[model samples]
Target chain A: MSGTSMTTRAWLLLLPLLAVMVAVIGWPLADTVGLSFTDAKLVGTAGNFVGIDNYVKTISGSNFQRSLITTAEFAIISVFAEMVLGVLAALLLNQQFYGRTVLRGLMILPWALPTVVNATLWRLIYNPEYGALNAALTQIGLLDAYRSWLGEPGTALASLIVADCWKNFPLVALIALAALQAVPRDITAASLVDGAGPFSRFRFVILPYLAGPLMVALVLRTIEAFKVFDIIWVMTRGGPANSTRTLSILVYQEAFSFQRAGSGASLALIVTLLVAVLAAAYAALVRKTAGSNA
Target chain B: MSALEIENIRKTYGAIETLKGIDISLDSGEFLVLLGSSGCGKSTLLNIIAGLAEASGGDVRIGGRSVLGVHPKDRDIAMVFQSYALYPNLSVRRNIGFGLEMRGVPTAEREKAVLETAKLLQIENLLDRKPGQLSGGQRQRVAIGRALVRKPQVFLFDEPLSNLDAKLRMEMRTELKRLHQMLGTTIVYVTHDQIEAMTLATRIAVMRNGRIEQLGTPEEVYDHPATLYVAGFVGSPPMNVLDGVATGEGLRLDGSDRLIALPVHFKNAVPSGKRVKIGIRPEALRLVEDDDRQPALKVAVEVVELTGPELVVTGRVGGQRVTACLPPRTKLAVGTTQAFAFDDDALHLFDAETELAFGR
Candidate 1:
């Protein structure tokens, strides 16, 4: 067959997918863009176009600004913590030890649980009355008495981050473990014979193999942490003066709770743009690391 | 003092013993090749000596000091691996200098040593490139450079040239020999290639099933193999064995009514009607005319292979297959009968049951 016909046939095969994408994604996206420019209600007649008023108000509002800062803090702190904890876990599990296979299998349990279920479990653990975490801390002489965890603004966001990390760090560990397996035994042996201590061996010989894969995990976890919603919503409902509120949670409150659809659409688009920028930066970093590794 | 010594080293994995009891001592500046086929425990012995793997029993010493529980880095050894194992992330210079860097050598001194090592290996131009950017031969040079820079008390190579193409392997083999001459470093090399063992080793230890079959100089190994396995393994076309039974007057060939005279020294060494195996190297057998005075065997020729320098002819002798290397231009054809004679001094006799060489 000629090249032109092949191209035509490829397009024909892709037509159904493209159509579905236009209906589900493209149409909704277009509608949201239109809605952002008008004063619209969740269930009422179409509002008159106000031309950039929603965008202006959303960008200037305290809610958008505070949520953006909160989202950034959560994403940066949680992703950094997850990467370190994950790599440490992976390194430990990679060693020769008893019950290693069982431990590796059990490591996936938290990640395997549904986000809502994981959030609910953490809530019980953080309960101010008789939560396991409070009981354990008091028993260990670290706490004077049981204190409000999820109910208080000071500890609410930190508690959510800990819970989020528990549910997500295993994914990073799994990726790192696979990369560790690909490191040739001979190279490590050579390094050992070259008079390298354990730390040097890991830094000079093993880290290069892990960098590319870990970068992938970093990008994924960072983006997920930035747009986090379900876990916080289920655990705290962005509670205690909105201290644990993230961009997604703010968007939900603006659109559904307050029924301000126009400004909600504007705020969501701004968050999407920020995430796109972060993803692009991480993609560039991945490319550079992959190139150097190759 | 010996440069390296392995004293009755043993390794066991669960119930299977990988190294039964290996003992080898190397003097300074001697190249000892552990020559064996795969699964022969040659690599296990090397690892034990390098302190990469622990020996279940016995102790290893370097420079007369026991290194049994010492870490590999503190053992004062350097190794070249089969895969080259050059750090793929670092430039060639850093790969060669990494050991010194780990030891906290000054930056300028490490760079100078790296440059000198790279120049000796003729990889000066590749110092700026990663291992991924080099050809197989170049990668091999970098691996050697990594080992050479340290100038350790002992050097171990685990089939370092096996990854190269045939031509490159030959080149690297020559290069290795040249390096050994220049540095005069104590070395232990491992390979299954007999040609490599013969050409490079001052002493070759032939191994089988986690035990040393024979250990001797290359000439001693080639000319006077101590065991049946060594005789079969150390030759290219390989040594051929014919079954015979000793008689009072001579030896009777199996499946044939021919009596061949044994060497005078072996005549009374065996009892009458005792079975023995006679090993003859292919090059030791020569085609002879019928009227030749030398005692000869009638061989039923099966195949003729003309390898550039010689004609290797495979044939049957008294129900046993034998290979003989003849003159390149000799006239020979398949399915023909020929008379072949071997020098009496070239004969090797082994008891059929024990497969151990008989006393001359």
Candidate 2:
């Protein structure tokens, strides 16, 4: 068969999926970009053309700027925390033990729980009066008092990060565990015989093997964390003075709470653009790694 | 004290015993090969010696010091794995130096060691390249270089050349033999390839079903296999064993009335009317002319394979199939009836009941 005909056949096979993508994803995204260039509001019946106004305001606005910084900080800190904790969990779970299978199954529970449910559960745990965390702190005499965890501005963002990491770290752990399994037991044994201690074995052998998978996990979690809204919304709703207002929550506030439809569309579009950039970078990195390994 | 001593070593995975009691004591600079088929516990034995796996029973000592509870790193051994197991991210130089760095060798010293070993392996030009950039043979040299830089008390090899192609494996085998001669280090090698074990080992320990079948010099094992299993397992094309009966005149082929004369070594030991199995190496059987047939058997040739310097011919005598190795120029074809004789002096007679070699 000719190359053109083969290409045509491949396109024909992909037609149905392409139609679904166009209808589900392409249409909404195009509509959001179009809507962003107009003066549309939730209360209005018609929109007036106002080019670049939404984008300009979204960039210049302090709330949007702060939300962007907060999102970046949240993503970096939480992903780093998850990577460290996930690797530790993977190492512990990789060993042979009597109840290891049971423990591994239990580790997936936190990741499997719905994000909304996890957010609500953590919110309850961080309750001011009758929270488990405060009670434990008081019992252990570590806190000097049962201070409000989620209610206080100083602790809320950090608390949310802890909750996000707890709910999300198992995903990282699963990836790291798969990578760790691929690492030959013999290399680790070789390292041990070469007088490498536990830390050295991890640093020299295990870390190099984990590098590719860890980068993938980092990118994926960063994208997810940048767009995080449901968990934060359920927990603090961008609480006291907008401390925990990430890009996703800021978009929601602009479009729904403040009823600035065009501006909200613009903010959402920017967040989409950021996520796309990360996804592209990750794909390029993975391709390079695969090529070298090949 | 020996350089390495393993006494009553055993390994069990839950209830399934993978390695039965194994005892080995080796002087410094000697090379030992654990020869076995897959699942015969050769790799497990290597791991146990490296302290990668704990022995369920008995003790392991390296350099005259007990290492029963020591970690693999503290055991003072360096290992080369079958898969090479090179760190994909690191350059060959870094990989070679990684061991030294882990052992707290100074950076300059580690660099010097890596360069010296690289030059020795002729991988100095490939030092800047990662394992992914190299060929199978290069990666193998780097793996060996990595182990060499450690300068450990003992070197462990777990079928290191098994991953290479047949041609490369042969070359690496020769290179490894040369390397051992140069290093003069105590080495414990594991391989399922009997040929590799035969060529490389100063002493071969043949294992079967988690137990050592026989331990001897390669020549001794080849010349005097201890058991029927060993006889069948070792040697290329394998030693052919046939069942027969000792009659009044000579040993009679089973189901045939012909009595074959016994060689001088077995003449005194042969008893009348006793059943026995006789083993003969393929090389010991020879084709003869019809007039020269003294104790010859007539058979139809089944297959004739010309392998460069020799012709491996398979033929049927009575009901049993027999093989003979002849000169390369020997003209024999399938379906041709040919007369062949077994060298009586080279014949191995075994007691059928106990599967032990009977004659002197």
Candidate 3:
């Protein structure tokens, strides 16, 4: 075939997907970028372009700086904790035992629950007066009085971290479990004949096999955590003097509650940029790992 | 004590019994092959010996010790899988040395062993590359190197060469025999190919439905098969069998008047009018003269196939298609009728109901 005809054939095959991308993501993203530089509210027909003002204001605000820190802290801590717990769970579940199928089915239930519902359930459990956590702590003689978990400044972020881990660690567990399943049974057998104990077998055989999926899960969970808004928004609403505030929560507050369209639009753009950077970093890491292995 | 001994081992999965009862003994430096078709429990028996799968009801002893409760790691055995299960993330050096590292071998010793094994397998140039960067033969060599570094008492192979192409398979077959000769270790290998079984094994165990049908040397099984199944399965083009009835002087074809004289032993044991299956190899058939010296049959040549070394000619004798092997340069063509005969001593007779060969 001629090069021109080959190029046309490739475009012909890609036409449908290209049309869908333009309609769904390309046009909306372009509209958002245009609106960010203008003074248009959600209801406005038109507005004058005011260049670089929103960018300057977005970078200079204390609220934006604090939320950026909060988002970073949330992303780092939650993803780390989830990775640890997920790997442990996957290891335990990978072993053959009685009732293994039932246990696997139960593990998937937490991941299958709605995120909003999980947040609501955790909120009730963290209530100060008669919640399950407070009741158990007092009953166990660890506390003399009931303490509000999501209300205290020192406890609010910690409480939200616990809730976020509960809601999302199963995703990591599922991914890790898939990776564990891919490890060849013969390699593990060979390790055993080499006089490796269970711990050594995991270190040498299982962990090396799981490296690819672990990196993938780490990247995906970090990106999801950086933009997390639903569970934290419902549970604490960035309360207790904004200690639990994140970039996504700030965007919601500025655009919807406080109605600062320019600041909100500018904050949203910054959030997009931050996510893009992390995604790029993860993409580079994955590509490097793949290329080296190949 | 022998290196390994299995006594009346049986395996059952749910209600379906796969392996009936199998008994095998392996001496030190012996290469034993369990040869059978798919679903014949050859792999299952190998897994049992490796301690990967437990025998439902039997004892497996290795080096005079029972390995029933021993873990696969503690069994002092290494296996190369058919898939060449290499660790994708690790370099060839790491993969080959991983077992030594697990056993607490020092880094210096591990490196020396890895280098020696890689040299033995001729894979020294591939140490820094991952398995994905190597060819199928190289990957297979790495798998062998991984097993060699363990220096275990016994080596188990589960059809390791079935995944390779024909030429590579032949090369690997030669290398495996050479390795066995040099190492002088006990090996329990499983394969469905009779040619491999014949060439590589000191003794061959033919399995059927999880039971050992016959166990002997290659020549013994090929020349003196214990049952009709063994005779049919051990040769290419298979032994030709036809149903007939024992008469006064010989056995007569069921639907025809042709009678074939049998040797003394078959004539005495086989009762008259009893149904019997007659088997004769294609190569055992020969062209005979129109004389009264011995009994003869007339057959019409239907097709002549000129293979490289031999000619396989199909013909019709007494309304049944029979094939005969002739010299490749013989003058023969389709639709040319000829008379063929076989020595009475070369005939094989089996009891039809039991499919067991009637002994001479």
Candidate 4:
């Protein structure tokens, strides 16, 4: 009797959380899986079971393949670039300077802003007619003429990557800076007295502390960059013959624009699977590095 | 020439002076310990000597060559920090060989040197393990090994054994002293532990308020403290001090009561009405069998503590709380009044106004 009452009390305490979790996460996930199996159109009669037809159609399409490649290219290049820039910025900001505290507070403003706002801001900055980038380039004599940045297929993806890096790299810097601070002062001092030069001291003493956090930041940035939608939508909208069409944009266009909800849902599921595989690989790498270091 | 010489070293932060100008020099194989309480700037002096910290004004010379603007890595000095500061990512062998590697020593030669240093430290088997795997004492040994492999002109230890447990600390203390004997290297160490200073140093510089109060051998400092503060600070269950007024024949303990009397033995006449403090080490005051000399302090015992080997008594000695270490099994009831005789030769007299030692 007592055990039953105790379990009842435990269930009472956990009920609200369980109800919220199922409502927010469980239902949509189950619904998405169910929809992936059917030929459900955005606007039509009730659809029949398509079995694996939607999955096959989504996979065999060249557009989906190209989008996957683009997503991978964008994520790998941008996350790598961001990691380097972020670590450098973190190192600079960690130093004792006149306005260090204020500068640190201001460093995260880009990341703090809404993603759409950041994308819109960058879109204006990349505008061929009156963008600051083109004006600066022309004034500096780096460019003979103002070239269309996001409007041209050759430069669109790279420009989107740069814009995306600028807005999100602060997350890495913030994490890296916190890790850098935890590197013991005495260890750095010890390295100095051990005849290490500044670069060597940073490599041997400070880099170890940075590796774990950098990996964690990389994981977060990779996942975010994989499903990137808002920035490309605002800046280029996968335009200039879809040169910057990522997997996320491809899935959205298939479902909402083309009204093929079954294939779109299947494509989205495929994207999720790809991201899950990549995330698992990253997690495995982190664990392996941690184990080996220990 | 002296191996390490600090000429007028000083450090300040805005309005606060952390280290007053300090001058010290050590012979080629001397183990010089900078002994002090916290905030005395011993560690600051060591840091300046190592070139880790810039002095406001000073010239530090190693092997008679001035290292005023030299980098710490080029200073021909290695330091062991209190935290052990072992590179967490590296194996013990790598940690030890890092300095040699930095100097561009050949790989085989560096490995051999690391091995030899590890063997010397009796940590040869633990070479492949990282710092995280080692015990506190082992990590400390590895830290010392790192410094030893550098083959520097001098070694600086900034309270290196402070992070270890008491038993391990004592063991490491002995190990350090033995290593010093074997190496005969010039070392400048900083520690607040007087026992470490006493047992390891060829000479101890007792610091107070960013200045060396006295510089002497361990025996000289303990047997003959130079100032009131030094006398009080140097000992465990520190020296008991009794303030009194100097009279024609001796010093009177109380203003009117005259609970205890201390005779001024120095030929330099102390003015009759001057205030003086009579300092006597707790061990120097004897519990008498037959009272030939009048006892200096007659007091009620407050706290009685059994500190492993000996019984420690905390009691009032003329309105001032003082500590005494008595022989084991010497019954000291909590509220009983007992007379303790002061040794004349062991008595330390200091002028109250100046706090300078008048006589020992």
TM-score of chain B of each: 0.97, 0.94, 0.92, 0.94
Best candidate per lDDT, number? 1
Residues A133-222, model 2: lDDT tens digits: 999998988888787777787888899999999999999999999999989877777677777788877887899889889988988998
Q: Write the per-residue lDDT of candidate 3 for residues A165-204, one digit (tens) a residue.
A: 8878888888899989988887776566666788877776
Worst-scoring 10-residue span by lDDT in model 2 chain B: B290-299
The 10 consecutive residues of candidate 4 chain A with the worst lDDT sum are A285-294
- The DockQ value obtained for model 1 is 0.84
What lDDT tens digits, residue by residue, belong to model 4 across residues B287-351?
65435366456656899898878888888855777677878778768987777776567777789
Flag regions of model 1 displaced more than 4 Å.
Answer: A281-294
Interface CA RMSD of each prediction in angstroms: 0.7, 1.4, 1.9, 0.7
lDDT of each: 0.92, 0.87, 0.86, 0.88
Pick by TM-score: 2 or 4, better one: 4
Over B1-360, each residue of candidate 1 has an lDDT whose tens digit, in order, gives 899888899999899999999899899999999999999999999999988899999989999999999999999999999999999889999999999999999999999999999999999998999999999999999999999999899999999999999999999999999999999999999999999999999999999999998889999999888888898999998998888988887777798787777888887678888898888898999888854467677899999999989999999987789899999999998999899988888888888888888877
TM-score of chain B of 4: 0.94
Residue B238 Cα positional deviation in candidate 1, in Å, after optimal superposition: 1.5
Estimate, for each residue in B163-233, the C-alpha lDDT of model 2 and write its tens digit: 99999999999999999999998899999898999899988899988898888889888888877777877
| Candidate 2, residue B325: lDDT | 86
Against the hidden true structure, what lDDT does model 3 obtain?
0.86
Q: Comparing only chain A of model 2 with the true chain A, what is the TM-score?
A: 0.95
TM-score of chain B of 2: 0.94
* Candidate 3 structure quality by residue, lDDT tens digits, B1-360: 789899999999999889898899889999999999999999999999988888899999989889998988788888888888787778999989987787779999999999999999999999999988999999999999998988888889999999999999999999999999998978889999888898899999999988898999888777767778887888776776777888887878766686777677676788888898887778878777656466555668898888889989888777776788878888876887787787875678888999887777
Docking class of 1: high
Q: Higher-lDDT candidate among 2 and 3?
A: 2
